[model samples]
Target chain A: MKQGAVDAVIRGLKAAGVSVVCYLPDSLFKELYPALDADPDIRTIPVTNEGEGAAICGGVFLSGKRAALVMENSGLRASIEPLARMGLGAGIPVIMLMSYRGDLGENNWWAIPHGITMEPLLNAMRIPYRVVRKEDEIETAIHDAYEWAYAAYYHVAIALSGEIVR
Target chain B: MNRFDCMEVLSAQLKDELVILSLGGSVDEWYNAAPHMRKASLFQQQLGCVTPQAFGLAVGLPHRRIVSLDTDGGMLFNLGILATLGNEQPENLFVVVWDNECYQSIGGPPTHTAAQRVDIAAIARGSGVKEAHVATDLATFEEHCRKGLAAREPYIVVAKVTSTVRRDIRRKHSDGREDKYIFVRHVEETENIVIMGPSEHN
Candidate 1:
């Protein structure tokens, strides 16, 4: 991931009033972790898995603060249960910032399914999402996700692609 | 002792601490034990998320104590939360796993804790929870609960209990959405922070 892109995402999270971030690290968004940790305004919790991260974000929401879950697209599959229980079932919103793997121009064969299953899963869960293929859309999409999630009281996903994760 | 007995003793030790109960029997029993504590009690319908949710609340509200009333079946579903809770090491968090060793709510199906004899406290310690204890009786359970609530470090207390159903276990006070609003409002009032706001369109 580009340093500039990471900075932009962080700025957007801060702008969205995200006081805490729970993430499961992936190679695609490796750079974002340290930057998130370094930020004084946001408390970052590196979780064991995406489901745990999702639940933590739900917990943050319950405590009257906004939180984002950062993970790889594959983690979306791992996090469906918590997302459904907390976000869909209970009406608590968890904004997710995921890196797009197995996307266009991808080299890894194992990563292909992640891209294939990401959208369908989000749709099945009725989670509105935006896939950011351009660097400029990164910040706005994240900000929009938070705004929409708060209003809708549901989970939202922002998939980072193109120059941002390249 | 049964789950209700454990909750009955434990509820007396609680103050204004936030509570997250696992799905099924824990929710009903806790509600019966402490109806007035509903504002602080988040009845988690999601199995396996009790501790994780409490961990998030603990991190978000660092100044307040967060208690997770969990069960063996639910804990088995997301055992990794033990490692996460251990790693995060929130000082104000305490987890109480009601180990009846079975999926008591749905049916009397034996879980790993009962059939295979899984020691949850050992797993907690191995997962990095420094203070983990298993209590087989009410006295030990209450003692551990009191210590865990008062301690500055995170603690996991597994109370060995019987799968005895209470006859007067009533329905929860509110549905999920209502519970959320009420709980959030309670947090706002107690913590003096504005969480939910009126609709802008209204």
Candidate 2:
């Protein structure tokens, strides 16, 4: 993943009107996390678990503020409950930006199964998502997502799949 | 009136029009002691999380009222939920954490929460929960709870109740599944949602 792409996401989130950001610790999202933390307009919430983060985002969005969740792909499974029950059920729009850890050209076998299942599971939930392989696409995708989210009060996601971090 | 009776009053007043997530400790004890909760089919979930669960429920069930029955001990575990709640301010949600001066779940051990005299309601205000207040006694609690429910913004009411609670009440659901499972099932069944967590849990 290009540094520019991560920066683009930060800019897009700010531009898209997201005021609260929730995330768990992840080495993969090193660059993006700090930038988000430093933003004065955004209140960054660090949670012990990804599930808690999801739940937090649910609350954040329900309060009528745009919110985002940053985490590794593995964290996805942990957040299943809040995502569905709160994110989708209440029409609270949450933008989930993930750093996909395993995929082609990746050596981490443990992360492979989850990475493989990621898209399919998201599809099963009927969540429309995008794979951000390049930096330029981040902004427009985010803008479109925000539009969809605010207009429909639904959740939107962007999966950073493949070997972008290394 | 007893703490349990206070909760019953809130439940009876709210009826099935709202959803609540009550935490452990005496709040759980009191909620369980109430005969109506056992008999009535309200959208109430008695699980591990009190405030956090309410946060999630409020997100999806936005149009309906959602409340969290929290305890000082449980709230201490993740007070950041308040910061998030304050920042998020879901108008349909209300947070009620009973600060009974002790960890009513364990052996009524004195909680450090009171040491700070945290004034949780003040904390809620500082954090940005639109409506926040602290109440002691049943009447005060009932009034605040009712006002919170009626408010147009997110509300937080911290009620100080007795630490002496029956220890024999069931602390958790009869089901053996951990808190993770309950949330995961909700995520799986819902659409347009993305979840993240539990790389591993003991």
Per-structure clash totals for the candidates: 0, 13
* Residue-level lDDT tens digits of model 1 in B116-181: 558999999999998999999999999999899988888999988988878787877677888888
Q: Which window of ten consecutive residues has the lowest lDDT sum in model 2 chain A? A: A85-94
**TM per candidate:** 0.97, 0.57
Candidate 2 local Cα displacement, residue A51, angstroms: 1.6
Interface RMSD, model 2, angstroms:
10.0
Q: How much lDDT does candidate 2 score?
A: 0.65
RMSD per candidate (Å) reads 1.3, 10.0
Local distance difference test, candidate 1: 0.88
lDDT of 1 by residue, A1-166 (tens): 8888988998899989998999888999999999999999998898888998898899998888889999999999999998898876678888999999988888999999998999999999999999998887888998889878878888999999877898
lDDT (0-100) at residue A88 of candidate 1? Answer: 62
TM-score, first chain, each model: 0.97, 0.90
Worst 10 residues of 1 chain B by lDDT: B193-202
Q: Which stretches of candidate 1 lie over 4 Å from their true place?
A: none
CA displacement after TM-score superposition, residue A15 of candidate 1 (Å):
1.1
